[model samples]
Target: MIPIRAYVAADFAGVAELWRAVFPDDPPYSRAEVAIPAKLAVQPQYLLIATDGERVVGTASGGYDGTRGWLYAVAVAASHRRQGLGARLVQAVEARLAAAGCGKINLQVRAGNADVTGFYESLGYCVEPRVSMGKRLGVNAGGTGTSGP
Candidate 1:
């Protein structure tokens, strides 16, 4: 059975693996890497993992700007693609954000990624021409995600 849970210390490696499988071109980072770890530790509640019994195959990281919710690092393993794992992870993250009093969720997709853009649109997200402009909270955001990456 597929289970989604809060990111635990033991699941770090699996999460990193999932990230690589989803975005092989990007450099992967260790969970204990100081930068990302510090940021995530402060808001562990916002990081989520999807697993088939301890094997994390999907991940979603959310950032809140004190009002709206921003989603990032959401990726499902290639082997698990198209089985609704991506959508499921987003739903789980958004649910938590809603409960935390976030007004709206915002994300960015690179103009080149048509397939990924379609995925977000199907989930009730519309394209906003505005570019993502923000100072990193000194966090370990693997890449920019205006919507889902």
Candidate 2:
């Protein structure tokens, strides 16, 4: 059985590879080699990974800033897809956020990604009628720019 657990430093390589495979078009900040470790440094418990023995098959990150919670970088390995691992990862994040006293949780799905949007909907997330905007900060790993929104 696949086990879901908090992400450790050793999981970075596997998680980064998984991110590249799952979100090929994601911005540089989202796919950077330092991203996972950076996030873990802030809130290690919020970064969760699912493993089939030693192999990393899924990952999710959650954050709470008092009033609101956010979910990010949720992915399940292609070989592990359709087995509910994605949902499990999401739930794990949600539970963490809720325990942190977060009232509302939000996430963004790329506009053209219908499958991903539907997956979130199935988990009780609804699209809010609001404009999403972003601004880049420093240099990104790919030398493009930072990613937000």
Candidate 3:
């Protein structure tokens, strides 16, 4: 198994290809070309990838928000699944979050993606009763980037 490492600019194409294959339902804005740079602008170190020599085979990203941490984009290529890469990816993010003083970590699996619930559960994650919500900052369609606007 390839050891996981931080993402590099050179890994862009491979990562993009891997994500397109793994998450075919993601929206346009979430495409690797758009999302990768946005993430790099912030906490790039938390963005990790596993590669087989030159091909990206896995990816996982984490975020620390002082009080809570989030695990995002945890995916392994279908060809690479069932070989413990998924578990390792999650564990890498968990280790980083723990190092940053995060006591709790949160992740959301789409309601339709029940198959992944068990995968996450095996990593010690549980489905909490709290509702998940989000608003893309600075976006159109009613949001104006101001709380009072």
Question: TM-score rank, highest first?
Answer: 2, 3, 1
lDDT of 2 by residue, 111-138 (tens): 8889999999999999999898876655
Name the regions of candidate 3 deviating beyond 4 angstroms.
139-149
Best by lDDT: 3
| Superior by lDDT: candidate 2 or candidate 3 | 3
Model 3 vs. true fold: TM: 0.91
Note the Cα lDDT for every prediction shown: 0.76, 0.85, 0.86
Per-residue CA lDDT of model 1 for 36-133, tens digit only, reads 58547667788888988767888888877787898878888887889998999999999989888898998877669999999999899999778666
Residue 116, model 1: Cα distance from true site in angstroms: 0.6
| Candidate 2 backbone collisions, by pair | none
How much is 120 displaced in model 1, in angstroms? Answer: 0.4
How do the predictions measure up, each by TM-score? 0.81, 0.91, 0.91
Q: After superposition, how far is residue 76 of candidate 1 from its true place, in Å?
A: 0.3
How well is each residue in 21-129 modelled by candidate 3, as lDDT tens digits? 9888786567798789989998898999999888899999999989999998988999899899999998998899899899999898988787799999988899999
The positional error of residue 96 in candidate 2, measured at the CA in angstroms, is 0.9
| Model 1 residue 140 lDDT score | 41
Model 1 residue pairs with clashes: 107-146, 107-147, 108-146, 108-147
Q: Give the lowest summed-lDDT range of ten residues in model 1.
A: 27-36
Listed per model in order, the count of residue pairs whose N, CA or C atoms clash below 3 Å is 4, 0, 0
